[model samples]
Structures are given as structure tokens and as C-alpha cells.
Target: MNSLQKGNGSVVRRVKLATIHLLALGVLSGVVVSLHAGEAISPRRLIEVVDISGPVVSPDSSQVAFRTEQASVARNTYDSVWYVQNTDGKTPPRRVGEGGVPLRSSAGLSLPAFAVWSPDGRWIYYRALMDGKVGVWRASADGSSAKPLTNDPADVRNFLLSADGKTLNYSVGATRDEVIAAEQSEYERGIHVDSSVPIGQGDLFRSGNVEGRLATQRLDVLGDGFARVPLLSGVPDRWKAIDLLTGKTRDLEASEVPSPQTIASALPKGESKPWRYALDTVNHRVALLTRVGDQGDLVQKPGVELSVLLGKNSPRHIECQAEPCVNKAISGVQWKPGSEEVVYTVSDPAEGMAQSIFRWNVKSGEVRLVARSAGLLNGGQRYGLEDPGCGLSSTALVCVAADANRPPRVEKIDLETGKRQVLFDPNASLAADISADMPVKLLRWKDAKGRLFTGQFFAARRTGDRPPPLFIAYYLCPGFLRSGYGGEWPLATFAEHGISALCINYGPFSFDAVERYNQGLSAVKSAVDLLASSGEIDRTRVGMGELSFGTEITMWTAFNSDLLAATSITGALLSRSMYLHGSLKGKEFISRAHKVWQLGSPDETPEQWKRIGLEFNLDKIRSPVLMQVPEQEYVWLLDSAVPLMLDHKADLYVFPQAPHFKFQPRQLLAANERNVDWFRFWLQDYEDPDPEKKSQYAVWREMKAHASNRGENPAGSRGD
Candidate 1:
């Protein structure tokens, strides 16, 4: 959901908060509340209302702290600190600090997320854009005395505090240093596509034609002491590292001189992009996750020599090269605490169902199962992806688990015994009160290309023989899966009204694989054909709901199929033309491959985009369309969606203060309750009042109030 503003500027949408029952959490203390798997959960009362973002965890796993914002239409965002005991039924969750006012340091435009407790358990370290760059800031774990950790001008990506808690090892780099350096050196190298910046600042003097290498440092815990590591030197496509402490220089890994034919042959095919290749490091062994081919490789250090980890496999022998394998699934790989055991996540898009945690011993290279998740446990849950959350101190593994019918709950599992403990149960009480409808059914159909396609269908449990009015959800994204759990409003809320929802899983979309591109678009037609044959769905009453890339699929489906009665879009694309000035992180592999991108690149594939970019083909979208654009999206979709709405006369509105990533707390609550109300009006002809529209968003209200007294946005406006 990258939304581009008018200029080159871009902003990531903050995370959203969903309601959690306070009474339920209070009752959760001291009680081992249990329910059969897949039981429907009806939240009694929101126990702890915390901003639902980031890895909200406590050091000891006893308590969890998170950012919760109170939403008001008149304001943009209202942020506050919230903490609650992580157990069953005992005490009511309480807000920390002065009443509802945010801890002074936490005030800002973005939602409060990425709340991480320091290793010492006394302070929390998070990012605050103070003093020109987003630097690390420390706050009392109880929400007090929050201040900047350093005034250095560096953008912090991730940080790690040393064992003694005095030294912090964090990775920070110049925001556009690489791009700027490359652009500066472009003419000298005559456009070497592989131009990069490496370490070694002491040797500012350059070899002929090579630019002075940009300085990258691996900071030591000691204040004012640092060392430099060069990712790329002036040398074309070379990696070298310089040890600042010892002043010794070394080559990181030598480059392979592939033949020109090999390079050219590796180009993308059709709408498919080449796979991103990387040397996967596991202890002493290394493997490559490559897009060019399926043959996997294992490499060792020093020589940077590669050996095949897996070879070509037959169709039936549990082939491991593609997914649910070591190369593709593992990320943030690390050794287990006090042991040589390595841990990683085997995430597979096809499995889309869940991510299984796997552990490999560094000493023996022996792999074992650690914890399996029903879906991605990391933030990937939103993108329908998953990764492992190793302990900050290397003792425990943190995981998130959920499925089609379950809201996720955070859990920590011990690597040694395989024992698990629940940290945050999102639906503990709801599970006790109501029975969830039957588990969603999975289906597989063969495509014209002889490939088997998989999808999920969830029907209302209400008894009746009448054909259910099926709602098809369109999906597109490299990080998410069609089967992954979406928000409660469209799926669960709609189910409560007796409408069946069918989620069409399309691939070779970004969510399935980056290299695959829009390969899955071909399958949507077949999926619709199958649904049309199903007697249980009323084809005339079908509806479509799309978010992000799903918006593309929904538009395609609606343009082609007369079955759909209406379409709802959020954080979606308005047109391919919008991508011209679109703000995508171009360093990513997909963006780098111009030829592959052009295959689906909205600009080059204008004809194709015109057919699918609902904005241009509105006449084809006879069904009333509801288009929503998040105010905080990476790209100003308003440029596209709003204009298209005006052109097609579609019903369109902006969800103020909401980000591309998540909704405001109040917005989420209202969305879950009232959004479905709007759908029911169109589907069941059920009457509901006009949804309340707030003049000011929750975030803006907070900002204006703070401005009234402080004379500026809490984060400081541009003019300030």
C-alpha cells in the first residue's frame, strides 16, 4: 500500500488498533480459559484498548505495553499509552500515566507502534523523528521521562542493546546515501547497474574512475566510538569491509563473473520477473534464494563458493526448492540462546495457511521444528506473511498464531522443550460465548496452464437451502495471501448478516512471489467460472471487496463479469497512470527490473492497465462501487480514486487519518459495526442510519488541540 504524495515525499501508514475486551481480559487472569479450536469468539467488552501495532511485548513476558489512540472525527489521531496483564481473567487493564493524555514524548502524527521493551526491563527504546532524523529514543517502561537516545543524524532501521545494557548495537545508515552516491557516479561508470557503496572511509583517496567510498559504520556501544564497514567501494560491483578498530580491510565476498549471455538470459519472461537471489547464511553454511532458476545452492565463507543445497526434483517427492524451504522462508536468522541452534521461519505463500517455525543447529546443521503458526506471526500477518521473532536476549521464541476463523494471539515457545505460553489472546472470551461457523473450506482447481490453483470459501452457518449471496474478495500483494486473515468488518461482520464470502486466491500476484509478478491474474477467470457453477451462490447478488492489489483483481473481475452487484475498495490503486509518479522503494528487486515491471508496469502496460484500472473503465463497472483511500497511504490515491469517482460517478470517500497499514481505533470499531451495516443495506436491503461522518479525524483533533497551546503540530510542522 505505497501511496505517493504530490512530490517525491512518501509516508508509511501507521498501524491500527482493534478493540479488546477489558472485562474478558480481567476474567482471563488466574483462569485457564479453554475452548475447542475454531470456536466463534464474541468479544464481551474491550479489556485492553492498545494501539494494535508492532511487537508489543514485555521483557519477562508477564505484561505487555502498547500505544492506544482515542479516535474522534474532529481530530486526526489521539495517542495514549496502555498496558495490561497478559493472562486470563483477573484484573482490569489500566491506562498508564496522567489520565488519557499521551506521555509527552509519544505525541506525534503517526500511530504509536514499534513499542519494544529494553533488555534491562526498565526502559523502552523506540524511534522518534527528532532532530532531523528518525533516531532511537528511550522511555520509562511505565511511560515516563521519554527522551532521545542520541542526537546523531542517522535513520535507524533496527537496534540491539548489548548484554550489560550499557552498549547498544544498532544499524543506521544514510537515508538516500546509496541512491545519491550512485546518481553522482552514474556518468563515470556509464551506468553500471550493479554500482554500490561499500566500506573503508580512511582511504578517501580513490583508484582511477572509482568514487570515494561512502562511509558505513557498525557502531560500538561505547559513546563516540565507531567503526566503518563498506558495503560497496568505488570498485564496480565489489564488496569490501574495513574494520575501524583495527584499520584492517577485507573483501566481504567476491563477485561471480557470469557470462554476458547468462546475464541477458536471466531477464524476466512474460509478466513474470526474475527471482531475487541472495546468499542465505546459516551458521557456516550458505544457500542462495534465486529468482533466475529453481536449483538451490549452499555456499561457505572465504571463497564465497556455492554448493547445491537441493537439486531438481520429481513432481511427487516432496520437492523443497520452491517454498516451505530453507532459502525462501527464513529471515532474521539467528542462533538460539546459549546454544548453537539456529532459528528461522519457513514461510510459503502457497501454504498461505500458516508459517512453520524451524530450527537448525549451527554446529551440526541439523534442522528441527520449533513452533508452527496458523498464519505469519510477525507483522507479516497484515501482509499475509510470517517470520520468526527470536528473543531479544536469545532465550525464547515469540510467535503469533491464528487462522481463517481466529484472531491472532501472541505466544512464546521454549526452543528446548517445545512448551508454549499464550501472551496475548485476542479472542479468548469471544471463543467462550459463541460457536464459530464451520471451518472455511479449501478448494483447488486446475488452470488452463495445467497448474493447480488453491482458494478458500467460507459460507454462513445459518440453516437454509437458498443460494447464499457470495462476496468475492480481490487480493494483490507480494507480502500477503488470499487465505490469510483479513480484518473483522468485511468477512466476519458480513457473515453475521448471513452473506457467504468467497475469497479468490489469485497468483502470480506480488503476494505469491515478487518474481511471479501478476501470474495469478490468469486464474481469476477460472475461479469466477467455478463459482458461477456452484449452486450455493447467487451469481446475481455477488459483491467484491478489494484492498491494495486486490483492488486490481476486483476491478478486473467486475469489468469482465456482470455477476457482481457492487465492489468495495480500500487502500487500492485508482489507475496505472498513478504509478508514473508513484512512490515505490525502487531498490527492491521488483522495481529494479524495468522489463519485468513493464510487463505489469502500469505505464507500459497501459492497455492492460486501462482494462483493469477501474478508474478508466468505469463504464464497465456498472455495479455501484465504494472506493476508499487512506489519508496516510504511501501514494496520494486521491489523485486517482477521487478523480475516478468523479468521472464514473462512483460513491467515494476518504477515511480521514487512517493509514494504508491500519485504521484508527474508533474507525476500526465503527468500521466493524457500521461498515457491515452499509453492506447489509445493499445486500439484504436492511436499513441503517447514515454512517456518522466526523469533521475532524482523531489524529487531527489531537494535533489542533496541541497546536492551540503549543502553537505547532506535536511532531512540529514544516513551517515550524
Candidate 2:
């Protein structure tokens, strides 16, 4: 008989006569089977994936408390709700906090984002905006007795309960008022004044000939562009340690908190963005992905470091890039279930290099190889902002797991032996519910430059005779279902409509403008050629789309190739100036992307700007395009969009003021919905059922008539 370890450390075994239990379950409807995957995804079932986020298993492992958010048409915003379910998944998750007053954040973000169960399992503590700012709130396990647990003046970004269940630690960002006051105080004290002048803006004017600067040598920047932005102060997340029972907070002001700015700039050896820490009190240890300053050269920069902390002991530095170590950034880490061992993931940058998982034993101080090409396929985010709660259970780890042939799946990995068990199947169930898996296969190829590229493809089924229309949805999709709430392309939804989706991941390009553009664009062209050569997807009906970096690539591809029949983009600035002048993050991204390809900075290499800049290449675009950008980002878009729109070759869609990564669910859903409509009309000639889309179709049909008269067809002419 098979044996299993229960959460309470009791051993359970299957009876000799297992057939009787199966017969009983078959006869009784009340006896439920867990993981009853319902149906394949379609436009109708898009809501199914929306509510499956932040599944937190209770401390006892008997139940799970997860957060769910849905786009509400009636309310014109997304609504956040919590759900409780048995760990076995036998029972359908039931919504909690019901009939209580609904809560929404002032920023239109859903409330109660991350939910964690109290040690006693009698309460669930979650982050929710109370009176315009986020604070911790607790609700009874049954969703009643909802009350505030902490009253912080600012939004709490992250919080966690200590292993002993006595210390509650959290982090919060500085508020606008705090930042302004600090700036004013500094100015009054004869410190540097904040200025609105753009970085390198003065250098160009200081030199009589701007062209001379680009042609001859690098312009000396007066100061770092982003570091000058007072609001962009590179402060670490401010932490607060609170006594759970007394509600007494011990803040930075009371403690000897290290100066984040000084620590960040002078990090000894660590070189990533900022240090992030996780505490495991049971082992009296803390783990941090951080950097330290070099004593010889304060300005010398380096990569990040992985270190461990023991009680009153200096952090035990784990050499991740030395002999007997991997030369890559530590991707993720998790404490072994009921143990002091830390499991982590890391990857190399070379082509065909797979992400690997490792286990570091704190007591033994030995890092053991765990799994190679590990669970990278699951849980995607362009920026790893929110933690997806990838952790361990009593005996196994429930996380996103993947392999070469299969996409990511919710899997349970044995913590000790590393054997895997599939807990949820979003693919095969779709095959059972619909017609076939529209089986997905890994697509591997090389660019003209011989740079290796890889992605995924959905095999076409159920469509008769006609080659499947192809749509390329991109931006570093590594695994199966994604974790974030916004900006995700509707891949499965496209597959359900009988259109095959090619999720392309390109070469990790450096910042050189030409190489970045060429290597990435060539990879995409190669993927398309492979698909077309297979005679599985129609070449003429090809379409492409992206948000953020993908949008920039789409523009470059449209300019470089006439292969795409249609495209959608989010980056719609009139010149490279906006990209160079926008958010610090965007500016750094542009600079790094260009530099990687041997391209110089804009101030030093104006020629490269003229080549890869999207605004300069609009005339070269043969495919019709759709421009969907946020209102805050429309400053330079007018000059760009009017020219494209005036040609009747593009459409400009303006959304409410929202950051690149932050979009209201309603807006995100609407964008995806409209994208589907645009592709359907242009690539498949399938008019949408919604009447609101009729005018759009009419315009598309008129464009079609013009194209037909000119002897062009996105889809091959039926006459052919």
C-alpha cells in the first residue's frame, strides 16, 4: 500500500482493498474529486483565469486563502475578493468578505491584494487601502469580524509575520509629502537643489554644435539623470517591525536603520537593483539578495550577491559567481519546508542555457545542485515586483513547473527527492473540453547572425483545409499561465478562435540600437518563416503585437519587414526624445538596450537614433497598425499618431492616466478585446459580434476595398 505523510506528522496508508473506496466515491456525488478542471478557454471563458491568483495555503495546510479580482462592467473597475478552499481542491472555492461593504482603492486598484493566514488560522491578514492609503487589515477566517490591524500613514507595500508569530514586519514607501518636506529641508540646509533640467540637456546646449558632440566624443553628464529627480530617490523599502499583540511599531526613526542611498551607491559587491530580504525566524536566520561596496573604488559597480544571516552572526556570503558556483544572478529562493535549507533558482545568459535550481544548507554551508532548466516556464512578469508566493508544503512544493515539451503547470515537487506531480492541467483539460490541445510545441531557430532563439507554438486543430492565421504575442513569456493581472496578451483566447499563436522569445539583446533591433527582428522573421514553411500557418495572415519593450520591437519589425499583415503597439512617441526623457526606468532600458548592441548614447551617437527610432520609420511600415497608449504617455504621441492616422493606416486609442505596468482591469480587458477585434477584422475578415465594433469593421472593410483595388490582400485572395 502507498504511504503519505499528513501535515500533523501522522503516516497514512491506502487500504489493501482500494477498489471499495473508489466504488464508494463513484456512487456518491457528495464525495468530490479535487482538481476538476472545468473547460477550455474562449472569449466567453476569459474570466476563468482572472480569479486564480495569490493562492496562499494556510499554516496548518488544511485550507487556502487566495485573492481574486475581476473586471466589473457595472462598476467600471475591478473588484477584489478573497476565496477559501480546501487544500485538496475537492471543494469549489467560495468567496469571502461577502455582503460586507465592498472596498476599492483610490487609485482604482483592487484592495486586499496579498492575503496570509494568521498562525492560529482564525484570521486572515491582508493589505488593503483604508482611507486612501494601504494598511494591514484582518478578517475572521470565515470573512467576518473585519477590522484594521495597523494604521500606517502611507501604503504598506509588503508585510510578513515572523516564524515565531510574534513579530509582524512590513515595508512602506515614502509619501509625497514626506519627499517634498525632505527636499525642502535639504535645500534650506544649503544642500543641492532639485532642478527640472533633463540629464545631459545642458551638455548639448553648452556645446555650440550638438552634432559635433555626437560625431566626436561623449558629452560629460553634469549628474545622473534619474538621481537628480528628487522624487526618484533610490531609497530602499522602509521597514517596520510591530509586536502583533501590542500593535507597537518599531520604525526606522527609532532603530539604527542604514542609509539606503549611501548603502545602495556604495554596495561592496552586490550589483542588482536593490537589496531584498526574507526572514526565517525558526532558524534565527535572514536571507538577502544584496550588494556591498568595494573599499578601493567606491564608484566601482558589480552584480548582486546572495547572503544568509544567523543570530548575531555576520551574513554567510554564498559565492554565486566563483569556482564551483554558477555565473548568474540568483533568480529566486525559498526555505525548505520544515527545514533551514534554502532553495533558489539562477540562470546563465548564453543561448540554450536553462535556469537551474539549487539548495543551500545553512548548517552545512554547502550548496547542492537540485534541478536544472528548472521551473522557469511558469509565472512571468517583465519586472519581478510582486512575490507569487512560491513556497513549500509539508512534503512538497506547489509551484509553476515546466519541461521542454510541456508548458508550465501547477505542480507539486517532492521537497526531499525532487520528484514532480502535476496538480493542475490547464492544457489537456482544454483539449478534453474543446477539441484538442491545439497542442503547443517549442519553436527553436536561429537569426541570420546565428543567434539562437526560441518560443512556443499552438498546433492547429479543428479548422478544416485552411492554413491557420498566425499571431505573434511576445515579451519574455517563459511558462504557462502568467501571474500578474494586467498587460498579458490573450494567447489562449486567440487559440480558441482557431488562430494559432506564436509566443516568441528573442535573443537577450544588449543596448546597441542596430544589433538590438536586427537580432530581435531577425529572430521573429525566422520564427515566422519556420511556421510558414511547415505549411501549418498562413503567411499572408500574419499579425503581431506587444506592450512596453515588445511594442518597441514590433515597431522595428514593421519597419524592417513587410511580412506582417497587421500590428498593435503601445509605445507611440513622435521621436526618440520621449523615450530618452520619460521615466528613469524607460530611459535606463533604452540606454542599456542600445549599449548592448555597441550603439552609443543619444548625445554621442545621433546616427543610430535616426535608424532605429520608431517615429522615423513609420513611412516604411506596410501593415496597418493600432496605437493604444495611456493618456499620461500622449505628449509626443500626437505628433506620431496624427501622421500614421492621417494616412488611414493606424488607429490611436487613448486610455486613462496609468503607468506602463499599472492598468485597470477594465482597461486591460477592453484593450485585449479590441485587439482581438482588430486582428479578426484585418487578418481573418471576421467582423465582431458587438455592434460597437461595426464602425471599426466598416472602416476596415473600406481599407480592404482600397487594398483590393491596389492588388493587396492580408489574407490570400479567395480568388487565388
Local accuracy of candidate 1 as per-residue lDDT tens digits, 118-142? 6657766665544335456666654
- After the best TM-score superposition of candidate 1, give how far the Cα of residue 421 lies from its true spot, in angstroms: 2.4
Question: Where is the poorest 10-residue window by lDDT in model 1?
Answer: 219-228
The lDDT values for all models are 0.42, 0.53
RMSD (Cα, Å) of model 1: 14.9
Candidate 2's residue-wise lDDT over 1-720, tens digit each? 000000000000110100000001222222222223444454323423332245566788766665544444334444455556555656454445421222322111222235777788777777665455556777776645677666776556667766566777877666645654654564466443123332322221121111011110111122222111123233457788788788798885646443322323333345444455555645555556664434232222234566665543443444444332443556566666577677776644342224666677766667776555522522321123334445456654555454323333344455568666554433333334433444556667876767677676666554677788888865555444221122445666677676778776655434345665676688778888887888888888888887655776777888898878888876443255454453334444455334333334566666766687666676787788887775434554665677777767778777754423334446666677777787777767787678877887777777666667656666623421
Going through the candidates in order, what is the number of backbone clashes in each? 63, 19
Candidate 2's TM-score reads 0.69
Any idea what lDDT model 1 has?
0.42
